[model samples]
Every structure is written in C-alpha cells, then in structure tokens.
Target: MKRTLSAAALVLLAVVALPTAANALEGDSYGPGSCNSITPASVARGAAVSYSCSDFWVANQTVSITIDSSAAGVSARTLSTVADAAGDIQVSIDTAADPAGTYTLTATQGTVTDSSDFTVLDPADAAAAAASASDPSAGGNALADTGFAGTALPWVAGGLLAVGAAALGTVVVRRRQQA
Candidate 1:
C-alpha cells in the first residue's frame, strides 16, 4: 500500500510539473521582448528602416537598440529609447551611410535581448525588390520558409511524458498484484 501510494504521489508530482516544464521549453523559442520582425525587411542602401517590438519591456523602461554588421568598414550603431505605456518600442534608423550587407538589429532591456536580421541591397537589387514588393504574389522581404512550423515540439514532449507515466503506472500495478 505504501509503495502504491508512493507511486501515486510520484505520478501526481509529474502531472503537476509537466506544464511548467513545457512552458519553460516554449519560453526558449518565444520569450518576452523577442523581436518579432522588422518592417521593409530589405531596404535600399540609403533608406530608412523601422521596427517595432512589444511585451519584453516595462512602461518607461529604457530600451537599447543596436544595429550590427560584419561588412568591412561598417561599425555597429546603437540607439536608446524608453518603452511606452503599452510596453512597446518603435524606432527608425537612417541607413544612408551603411553599405550593402546583411545586418542584425537587436533590442535589449536589462537581461532580455532579441534580434532579427535585415538586408541592405545595392541599387539594382533594391529596384528589383521594390518591383516585387508591389506585386501581390511576391512576398516582400519575408523570411524564407524553413519548413518547421515551430509549435509542435512542446506537444510532442508532453505526449512522450504522458506515455512514460502510463508505462510506469502499469509497472507499479503489476508489481502490486504480484506482491
């Protein structure tokens, strides 16, 4: 009877703990203040770019924005602003002096940081992108579909946990019957 109670207690603990573990895993992929996207994801070498992010900051908190590039002769640029009451930060940066390259835009508030990538194109490519942007069929500056929908892993993990718990319960019941 004690063994049965112990087994039951263990199962109950696992059942209670599963959701918290699943949430932690989900948080790794979709944490607060994660940069969702940047508007006009591709831009002409000397155009303005804007991005908005929310939920990663508190009202009136100072958020630091950084644009970093690995292109030769380009230095990282940094900007700071306060989040609004809605805990959102939006900023526009002029890339007039930035050369054609891929850049990462990051936001930081205290310990939380998130980043997204954007591209700056030469005149010829920029014109092509602009032309495509106007076409309804062309998804302008969208991230490439990597074929992973990103929402399945947590469910899979939880399912596996449930299966394991069932197997353990079956073992415990069989042992009790044999005893």
Candidate 2:
C-alpha cells in the first residue's frame, strides 16, 4: 500500500510538474507581448488610448508590432526593434485619430504570433458602448441576438448534454438478479 501511494504521489507530481515544464518551454500560451491582453483598452473616438505590450523572446529572434484600424481612417505607430536579452519589446498606440470600432493589434516574434483586439469607441455609439461594456462579445451581434455573440453556446451545450445522457444510460445496466 505504501508503495502504491508513493507511486501515485509520483504520478500526480509528474502530472503537475509536466505542465509547468511544458509552459516554460512554450513560453506564454498566447505568445509574447501584451499580445494576450489589451489593457484599459477603450477610449473616446478622438481620445488617445496609450497602452503597452510586454515582450518575450528567444535567441536570434526578431520581433515586430503592428496596430491598425480597418475602419476608413485610423493610424498606428510602427515598432521594429531587436528584443532585449529578456526579450522585452514595449510599444504604445495613439488611438486619438481612429474611428470607432475594433482594431487589430498583432505582434510577431520569430515563429510565435500573437494578437489582441481593442476597441476605439465613438462617444456617440451609446448603445454599442453600453453593450460592449456589459460584454465585450456583444458588439459583434449588434444586429443579431442579445447576451453577447455567444447566445448560441447554451443550445450547443444542451445538445452535448443530451448526447451525454444517452451515453450514460447506454453504459448503465438495470437487471434483476435471480433471487
């Protein structure tokens, strides 16, 4: 029993430690930079949104940052710099002149690619602004259903539940044993 417990402990320890090792090797799951996050991201249409991206790196790697708006007229600063020893590449954006909509923020470092979605809110988009503040995914469904763009997730989930119930019942046996 002691041996079995020790083995179990080792197995659990390996399971826990393996992910850490893999994560370290994989760096960040979403890759380098604030690529995984867009902080304090919303601002008035003509108002400036100053933000930065944290960096990540490997030896001899190249890093680039691009921020742009697909909404008619918008601009972003270009940052092309060699990563620091720690792979730090910081950048800022001036959203003051951009239109009101979501913009793409992409960072490329060697083989790793990361992106974050940010919104430039027009002071006039009150309904959209409110919906977005309530739920970020709501903006995409402005013409569709409520409760964000994932209003269908529950239905899909229900279907999965029904399938799961059928499978469970199939695996269970109810038979009267000879008395």
Candidate 3:
C-alpha cells in the first residue's frame, strides 16, 4: 500500500510540473525594457513604418530612434525627436527608401528604452511568410524569437504521466490480488 501511494504521489507531482515547460516563451534576447513597438508590426518593401512611445521618463525629453537593417546596402541609422508635454512621441519611417528585410527599431529616452521588430518584404512574399509563421509545421513562432506559441512538449508529458499512472494502478491491483 505504501508503494502504491508513493507511485500515485509521483504521478500527481509530474502532472502539476509538466505545464511549466511552456514558460520558454516569456522574454526576448534583449533581456527586458528594450522598448515599446513599431506600429503595424510589418510593412511591405517601399512602404512606411510608424512608431510611438508615451512612457518617456520625462516630458519634452529627447528620444532617439535607431534602425538596424538586415538588408544589404542599407546600413544602420539613428534619428532623434522630442517627446510632447504629455510624454508621447510619434515618428514615421519611409520604408520605400530602405531595402527589403527585417529591421530592429529601438527608441531611447534617457536610460529607459524599448525595441520592436519591423519587417519589410515584398507584397508577394508577405503572405507566404505570414502563413509559415503561423503554421505549426514550419517551426511555429518563426517571426518571434520568444513567447508561448508553439510548444507541445508539456501536453505530451502530461499524457505520458496519465498512462503511467494507469499502468501503475493495474500493477498494484494485480499484486494485491496475489497477496
């Protein structure tokens, strides 16, 4: 009976612990407080991209905008603007003038900063890319480096734990009958 109880307890612990495997989708490579975001998330090649921030540490503060492009010929660029009296600032980028690829857009005010990923692709390529990013077979979360989107290992473990418990129960009953 003690052995059966121990086995049941182990199965309960495993079921509770399996769900935590999904925690891998939490943060990004930049640690935290990288920046806010770029509006629209993505844009076609030769289009425009916009971004805003309202969490500046101070009003009328100067925030720097930096674009680090992955496309060839188009190098990294940095620009600056001042936040309004309400600590909000809006800026736009002429993607039409830039190359086609992914770019990292970061905004900085004083030591506080935020960053977002902006993609510039041809219209024809955008749909396929979007489909693949959302498709589970093609490495789900392809566009995002972190966040909980495509993890199934936890559920698999939970199922396995249930099977093991059932098998253990069967074995316990058989042993009790023999005794």
Candidate 2 local lDDT, 1-179, one digit each (tens): 45445554665575557657766855656554343356656766666544344555653456677787677756665666566676655555666567778888777766776677888777777455666756747644345445477876886677557655644443342212212
Task: State the local distance difference test value for candidate 1.
Answer: 0.81
Model 3 residue 64 CA deviation (Å) reads 1.1
Select the stronger candidate by lDDT from 2 and 3.
3
Collision count for each candidate, in order: 1, 0, 7
Q: Residue-wise lDDT of candidate 1 within 26-139, one digit each (tens)?
A: 574565544557888988888888888866577799989899999999999899999998678888878889999999998888887778888988979999877886775786
What is the overall TM-score of model 1 with all chains considered together? 0.63
The per-model lDDT (C-alpha) reads 0.81, 0.61, 0.74
Q: Is 1 or 3 the stronger prediction by TM-score?
A: 1
lDDT per residue for candidate 3 within 1-179, as digits (tens), equals 67667767777676667555545444443233223468778877777878876444357878888999767788889999987786777888888776678899877777887788988888778778778779889866745566666577777776887768786776778698879
Ranking by TM-score: 1, 3, 2
**Where is model 2 more than 4 Å wrong at Cα?**
1-36, 50-55, 58-62, 73-78, 124-179
Q: lDDT: which is higher, 1 or 3?
A: 1
